[model samples]
Every structure is written in C-alpha cells, then in structure tokens.
Target: MPEAYATSAVASGATGFAPTGGVQPILSVKHIEKIYGTKDSVTHALAGVSFDVAPGEFVGIMGPSGSGKTTLLNCVATIDTVTSGHILIGGRDITNLRTRELARFRRDELGFIFQDSNLLDTLNGFENISLALSIKGAPANQIAAKVHAIAETLGVSDVLKKYPYQMSGGQKQRIAAARAMAAEPKLVLADEPTGALDSRSATVMLEAMEMMNVQFGATIMMVTHDSYAASFAKRILFIKDGTVFNEIRKGDTSRKDFFSRIMEVVSFLGGDASDAR
Candidate 1:
C-alpha cells in the first residue's frame, strides 16, 4: 500500500492496525460493570463483562432485548465509562485515561457503526468520511483521494457526491461502512449495522464487512440480534440480561451451518426461535 493511503487509513479515526507480529491484542476489556445509579436504585448495565480481540479477528455479540450488548459496546468504545473493571487498547490501559486522553484514544484506536447511518445530512458521502479524517488532523490534500479509495473498496464510489438522503437504505449503510473502515481502526464496533435493512441489503453490508476483515485485517466487534448477520463473524458471544451467556466459534463451518449453530445457541439462551428466520 502507498504511504499516502496508509496515512489516510491512520487518520480515519478508526483503526485497522497494520501488521504487528503475533504481538498484542488491539482491545481488551475485563470484569467491567456499569450501574445506572446508586446501589439501591441501580440498573446493572454490564456485570463482570470481559473479552479480548486479537488483530484481524471478526467477532459478534448477540443477545435478546436488554441483554447489555449495547452497554458493553459503549464501554469499550470509550463513549461510556465503566463503574468498575478495566479496558485496554493496544495494551494501553484506557479505563483510567483522562477525558482528553480517552477522546484521543477513541479517535485514534476505535471505529464505530451504529444502527443509524449517523452521516451528516448536508455533506456528501465522501465528506462524511473525510470529516472523520479531518477531526484526526489529516492534511486536506490527501483527504479526497483517501476517501475515494476507501469508497471504491466498499463499492460506494458512485455515490460519493450524493448526500445521505439521496441514497437508498442500503446505499446509506454501505457509505456508513466505508466511513467506519475509512480510518482503518484497530477494531470496528458495529451495533446492529443490519438492523434496519432488508435481507438483501443486510447481506450486502455483512459481506462488505467480511471483506474488510479478510482483506484488510480489520478487527471487528459487532452487536446484533440477527443470526444471519452473526454468521459472517468468526465467533459469536451471546449475552443475556447484562451478563455473558455463552460463546461459539465458526471454525470451518459453512455460513448455513454457522447460522444453524447460532440459532441453536440462541435457543439455548432461551431466545425466541422465530427471530432466527
């Protein structure tokens, strides 16, 4: 890859870390817990949550409603502070980082894709991505070229100049995916990226994320209620009522087989069978 491209990837405010020898984890969370209020009236959003993601791993977090998947994502994303426990990115302890440092850590180390596109309504697709680079202080001359390159990789170059509203639901989500991967974050956190799309669109988005993981060595942690979407991940960690219920790995399993396995695990977790379809 060209230095110009690499610099842009680094600037994208998300990370797909470059090859580090079988070295260290890109992100780690341990014994994390979050309580919404004081002890008596507390709502435990996360209870002793723990996980580690290696470089280039694709992971999914699945659960029924109110399962704390989103809460877990928020804590690791550095958007919410944990009441207890620790989080580290690139082996740097982030749980204790000051506000400004945590902001920088989030910008330099993590990437996010929420259920909503979260693109600026007025900006074109390219601008939405470029804005992330801009916040990271990337030079202006390199922004357009890098955004174009990432958009091409995500198959959204045709809509580069179109505003978010001008695109279809699938198109918007693709653009959002491009933005998430644009910064080449060491880890990408996606919360229900396919939740709002039709099946065809969701498949397209999942395939794009899988390509990023396989080709760019992008590490990903996604939260979803969809078994089909979870099938794209190498492993799935199931959560229930603010605690981890179980986990399953895909290994050499085919997507169909993986989907069935995921459904079985979901059933074991007492998730509704109807939702699997």
Candidate 2:
C-alpha cells in the first residue's frame, strides 16, 4: 500500500459526516488485481490495488487515462471481476458471492452515479427517484418519504414533478443523485459525476454531492480526472500504472487549497493540462 500523503488524520469540516472511530470500513479492496489477455500479450489494468473507505467518507480516485482507475471502480462495483484478491462491502465478500447473490447485493448495498444522469426518459424526477424503492417493494408512503427527504436534501425538490427534458443539466443530475441515495445503500460509486455539465452546472452538482456526503452520511468513492471535481472529496488516491502512487486527505485545508494540491500532484503525475483549473 502506498503511504497516505496528507498530514491531517481526518477531513476538515467533517462535523456532520460519520466518524470512522472503531468502525469497520464500509468498503474494502484488498490487494486486488485485474489482468487481461494471453501469454504473449498481457494488460495489467490493476495491480495490487488496496484501499478502504470508512462510513460517510468521500474518496476520489484520480489518474491519467489508462491508469486503471476505471478498472478499479468496475472491480469494486462488481461490474468486472478482479484477477485476484478480495472485496468486502459492508462486511460481505461480494467477489465470492454467487451470481444471484451479487445481483441482490448490488441492488441492496450499492448506488451508482454516472457521468450522464441516466434518468429514465419516460419518468419524471419523482418517479425516477422512487424507482429503486419501488423495485424493492417498499410501500407507497415509505417510497415517497424517502424520495422527498433525499430530493429536499439535494435541493432538487422543485424539479420533482418535471421530467429530465424539463430540467437543467444540474437539476437533472441532482435528481439523479436523489434517486441513488434514496435506497440508502451502504456505499455509492460515482464516475465523473460532473463531466457533462458546464462550469456553473458542475459547481451546483458538486455542491449537491457534498450535501449527500455531509448531510445524508453517504460513503462515496468517485473516479475523476479533473482536479476541480476531485477537490470535493475528503481524500484522494492517485493511481499510476495500476497502483496507488500517493494519497492525500483534506485535513484542515479548504477546498480551494485542496484543489491546488490536487493540481500539483496531477502535474507530478504527468496528467493532461486541461485537468487543472
């Protein structure tokens, strides 16, 4: 495991977020590996990747293209299998789960936010947010309550009655965020959540995600290439050549300062210049 880079023990302004004190990690990726191809040709997408995300902590994974950040996320999300090692979510070994069990585990324990909002074209914001609970056979009132609470927290309540076409990019994304958290999954995985939005919209979406972390107590592991987007995370794990090269925690630093630090690391890692502000 690479040594964590930041000095502070905990994230700055983590008052509302749940503490890791004496608690088991919400997600654990232990020396996991992913490789593809035959004897003559091999691709090491991920090599000995190991990390832990405590309850309510928000972590970012950043690396250059082909650095295996996406591969790592897929392995943790169980969309792709690891070549070796273990992944435990909420104390359950998902890598060893049967096909049926893995399906149930995904629906029950994981929430995903993608680059695109991925909202159903036919469903309005409220219906979209309620879909997960509806599939779980939750009662009408219970589903409504969960949707309302999450939408309100994400500041997307006003758009509940609107369809994706009727909302702004930021609004659509916020509603999508509400849907993911409505199920109150043990962990949320986000991939470039702000990638598709304009600067203003992206800022709004990031703020909503922050609320989801601090207010909703959701543990998130997001994969992003943009330093500005990554600044929102409490800590960052920088991947290089399929391994964790370094780590940084927010500590007492402000988001602006954290962003600068992230940019510095990006420079050191030979990341694309556009990734910086």
Per-residue CA lDDT of model 2 for 29-53, tens digit only, reads 8888899999899998887777788
**TM-score of each candidate structure, all chains considered together:** 0.88, 0.91
Q: What residue pairs clash in candidate 1, if any at all?
A: 12-183, 14-185, 15-184, 15-185, 15-186, 16-184, 16-185
Backbone-clash count (model 2): 0
Please, what is the whole-model Cα lDDT of each candidate in the order they appear? Answer: 0.81, 0.85
lDDT at 166, model 1: 94
How far off is model 1, as Cα RMSD? 9.8
Candidate 1: worst 10 consecutive residues by lDDT?
A: 10-19
Best by lDDT: 2
Deviation in Å, model 2, residue 12 alpha carbon:
28
lDDT of 1: 0.81
Candidate 2: the clashing residue pairs are none
Tens digit per residue, CA lDDT, model 1, 147-225: 9988888889999889998998888988988888877777899998988988888888988999889988999999888
